[model samples]
Every structure is written in C-alpha cells, then in structure tokens.
Target: MPYVLLAAAIAAEVGGTTAMKYSEGFSRLWPSIATVIGYVLAFALLAQVLKSMSVGTAYAIWAGVGTASIAVIGMLFMGEAAGVARISGIALVIIGVVLLNLGGSH
Candidate 1:
C-alpha cells in the first residue's frame, strides 16, 4: 500500500540522517556510503507513494515526520539535549502534520 511505502520512505530518510551524524563530513567510508544509499532508497519509495497520494499531503507527512524522528533520535541515541523546547517542537511538528492531513481530505 501507499502508506506502507510512505513509512519505508520516512524510515530511510531518518536512517540517512542518523548516518549523516556518523559520516564525519563525508570523510568516513562506510557511513558516507550508507547515507547516500539511505537517501536513494528513501526518494525511490517516496516516488512510489506519490503515485496514489497527494503531493501536499504526502510531502508534509514525510518532511514533518522525518524531522521529528531525527530530533528524537538525536536526543535518545546521539547524546543530544532533550530539553523542553525541543520536545515541544517535536509535538508541534506532529500536530502540524496531522492538521495537514486533515485539511487535505477536504
């Protein structure tokens, strides 16, 4: 289903971003290759999702979710700060994505 593809795309995007943190400005070999591969697969799956989903809706979800996911990943696993402001920001992003989907249905 398109939703499944969207989820995969989001996961790939998140993975790519996480790998980017370890890429050391692309100087590292394996992480750099992983980043490129992750993004390639993400875009490919996202393209498939677009076949049935509206661009505004799909892209909003993809970007919003990916951003929020990366933020959380940073806090939880990457030793980034998990301050209140950052948590609030992620909540806002999720709400915005939900609102976008709701509006797009009309």
Candidate 2:
C-alpha cells in the first residue's frame, strides 16, 4: 500500500537524520555513508508514494513524521535535551500532520 511505502520513507528519513548526528561533521566515513544510503532510499520510496498522493499532503506527512520520530529518538537514546520547548515543538508537528490528514480527501 501507498501508506506503507510512506511509512518506510519516513523511517528512512528519520534514520538518515539520526545518523547525521553521529557522523561527526562528515568526518566519520561509515555513518556518513549510511546517511547517504538512507536518504537515497527515503527519496525513492517517497517518490513511489507521491504517484497517487498529493504533493502538499505527502510532503507534509513525510516531513512531520520524520521530524517527530527523530526528536523522540534523540530524547530517548541520544543525550539530546528533553526540554519542554522541544517536546512541545514535536507535539505541534504531530498535531499538524494529523490535521493535514484529516483535512485531505482519500
């Protein structure tokens, strides 16, 4: 299903972003390579989902989900700050994604 593909794309994007944090300003070879691979896969899957989805809706969902997921990953696993402002921003991204889905036609 397209939704499944979309989810995969989001996961890939999130993974790529997380890898970026560990890439040490691109000095690390492996993580940097992984980041490139992840992003390539993400864009490929996202393109597939876009075939039948609206550009606005698909991009919004992809970016929102990817951002929220990476934020959680950072808070839970990475030593990133779990401050109220960051959490609130992530919540807003999730809520905005949900609202976009609700407002769109199937």
Candidate 3:
C-alpha cells in the first residue's frame, strides 16, 4: 500500500540520517555505505508511494516524519541535545503532519 511504502521510506530516511552522523565525514566506510544504501532505498520507496499519493501530501509527510524521527534518533543515540524546546518543536511537526494527512484524506 502507499501508506506502507511511505512508512518504509520514512524509516529508511531515518536510518540513513542516523548512520550519516556516525559516518564521520564519510570516513567510516561501513556507516558511510549504510548511509548511502539507506538513502537510496528511502528515495526508491518514496517514488513508489508517489505513484498513489499526491505529491504535496506525500512529500510533506516524508519530510516531516523523516526530520522528526531523525531528530529523536539523534537525541537518543548520538547524544544530541533534546531540550524541552526541541521536543516541543518536534511535537508541532508531528501535529502538522497529522493535520496534513487528515486534510489529504478528504
């Protein structure tokens, strides 16, 4: 399904972003490879989702979810800061994504 494809894309993007942090300017071969592969799969899956979803809707969801997920992953795993303000901002992004999806379904 398109939604499933979109979810996979989001996950792939998150994985890519997380790996990218560990890539150390692409010096770490394994993580760098993983980052590339993950990004490729993410885009490929996004293209599939675009076959059924509106470009605007799908793109918004992809970007919103990918960004939020990556931020959370970075905060949790990469020791990146997750202050209250940042968390609130991420929450707003989630709210916006939900609204976009709801509006798109109608």
lDDT of 2 by residue, 1-106 (tens): 8889999999999888888889999899999998998999999999999898888899999998998898899899988899999999999999999899899825
Clashing pairs in 3: none
Pairs of colliding residues, candidate 2: none
Clashing pairs in 1: none
- The deviation in Å at residue 8 for candidate 2 is 0.3
User: Could you list the CA RMSD of all candidates, in the order they appear?
Assistant: 1.3, 1.2, 1.2
Clashes per model (N, Cα, C within 3 A): 0, 0, 0
Q: How many backbone clashes does candidate 1 have?
A: 0
Model 1 compared with the native: what TM-score? Answer: 0.93
lDDT at 30, model 3: 95
Q: What stretches of model 2 exceed 4 Å from their correct place?
A: none
Worst 10 residues of 3 by lDDT: 97-106
**Poorest 10 consecutive residues of model 2 by lDDT?**
97-106
Candidate 3: tens digits of C-alpha lDDT, residues 1-106: 8999999999998888888888999999999999999999999999999888998999999999899988888798779999999999999999999999889732
How much is 75 displaced in model 2, in angstroms? 1.2
- Quantify all predictions' global Cα lDDT against the true fold: 0.92, 0.91, 0.91
Instruction: Write the number of the candidate with greater lDDT, choosing between 1 and 2.
Output: 1
RMSD in Å for model 1: 1.3
